[model samples]
Target: MTPFTSRIYLLRHGEIVEQDVLAGGTDLLLSDVGFSQLSQACKYLTDVELVQSSTLKRCSEFATQFSHNHQIPLLLTDDIREFNFGDWDGRKYDELWELTHSPSIGDFWQSPWLVTPPCGENMADFYQRVFLWWQRLLMNIVNNHTHKQLVITHAGVIKQLLGIICELPKESNQQNMFAVGYGKFVCVEIYIDNMGKAWPKIVF
Candidate 1:
């Protein structure tokens, strides 16, 4: 068995406009505070190698800055877009709470995996896309044999990645695993064992 080391760093993009709402799939740019957060995050990753971000503007903006300063190419992929909120996009939690007929939203509040938003994607679908994306990313890391790979994406994307890497149950909680404030960052170190399995060893 051969031990291959591939370190992947997952980062949730900074805050966006209307964050208090359930703005899933809404392609809004980062807020002013988000810019500050992105700047702070760049400082922490000054030594990172490859950089990538979701196609969405919020993530892409920060990725551009990081790549520019570090002189590393920034790649964009659609695999990391935020969860599609469907009809719920651009609406706030309070608005959803006001809907009297739909108990489904309440169910989603309790267990996000159980309730599929009306006209939106189910948890399984979301997980599958994320998993596929991660597999591709892992393949790239293995091919390049990079020591550090930085990714800027959404909170939902980060949560799914954590679940996969940590081997957490699919039904695990989804509360703020990386609710990284605008410009703040969470560092996760993924290690590849001798069997070619990648797992998160350290997260900060």
Candidate 2:
């Protein structure tokens, strides 16, 4: 029997314009600070291989810089995009808070995992999409046994991945689950033994 090993570097994209604004799927570019963050992160990860990022501009732009610095190709995938806030898109927190008194808004906040936003996906559905992408990477490990892969994506996607790796409850503490800072990274090692059972070991 053969053993396989894979390492994943999960990176959150840098700060963006109007973070408090629910600009889901709005395609906003990164701010100046975001550029600096990307440069610093690239300097830190000088040896990472296989760079990939969400297709959105904010994520892809920073990924491009890292890819150039590391000399790795950048692949874009939609599965790692930010959560879609639907009717709440482009609105600030204060604006949304004003409307939170409505029953529909209340329900959306109370059970975001189960309740779909008007014309948008719920947290579960969004996680499913992210999992699909991760599944593809696992398949690559099974076939080619690649050692290291870097994924640059939105904060929400990173949080969902953490939830899966840690086996936390579906609606676990949001603060702890998604606290990845701008341009920061977390590393996970997936170890597969002779029987092909994979265990994820996280290294912060």
Candidate 3:
């Protein structure tokens, strides 16, 4: 077996106007500042061969525009959508805090895996789905000899991917949190061995 190198650029969408509102899975578009942020960051992208994004407009809007501008093939999938807040989708955190009165909201921030929002996606299921999508993405790039691929997605998705690549513990410990900010990106390089095993290295 021959070894190869592939890069995946994990991009978090830009700032949204509704930052205060918990907008998970709400289909909110980017703010003007958000668009401007992404536009400035686009200068760093070079030699990108493929582009992918969440089906949500906030992510897909920028991905579509960037892919079209660069003339790269773009794929929109829901696999990378943010963790569904469910009933708490549009509510503000302070309101939920007052209603619950258990500091569950605060606890959730510290240990999301241990605390799930009402009717929201549990950490286990969210991890499973996102990891499944990530594996498929890696295999696709390796088989196709794709050198560089950009993925526009949510912060939760990015953090989970980072945890997987970094071999972080499954527990929701605040110290272990890997946060990716809006309009920012993390690059990982996939390394294939002679036996066809693939490992990832955080490049940028």
Residue 131 displacement (Å), model 2: 1.6
The full ranking of all candidates by lDDT, starting with the best, is 3, 2, 1
Report the lDDT tens digits of candidate 3 across residue range 1-204.
688888888889999878788888889999999988888877878999989999999889988999999899999998899989777787887776666544366777777778787778877888888889989987786677788889989888888888888777756443245678789988898887777677899985
Give the per-residue lDDT digits (tens) of candidate 2, residues 19-119: 77876777888889987887777675645668889988888987887677668877888889888887877778777778844436557767776577777
Q: What lDDT does candidate 1 reach at residue 65?
A: 79
Q: For candidate 2, which ten residues in a row score worst on lDDT?
A: 169-178
**Model 1 worst lDDT window (10 residues):** 174-183
Error of 3 at 169 (Å): 1.9
Question: What TM-score would every model get versus the actual structure?
Answer: 0.87, 0.87, 0.91
Among residues 3 or more apart in sequence or in different chains, the pairs in candidate 2 whose N, CA or C atoms overlap within 3 Å are none
Off by over 4 Å in 3: 101-103, 174-176
- Per-residue lDDT of 1-204 in model 1, one digit per residue for the tens? 456665667777777876678767888898888877777766756567788898989889878877887789788988788898777777888888777766457777687777888888788888889999988877766566667878888888877777776777777664345354455455666666776666656465
The model with the greatest lDDT is 3
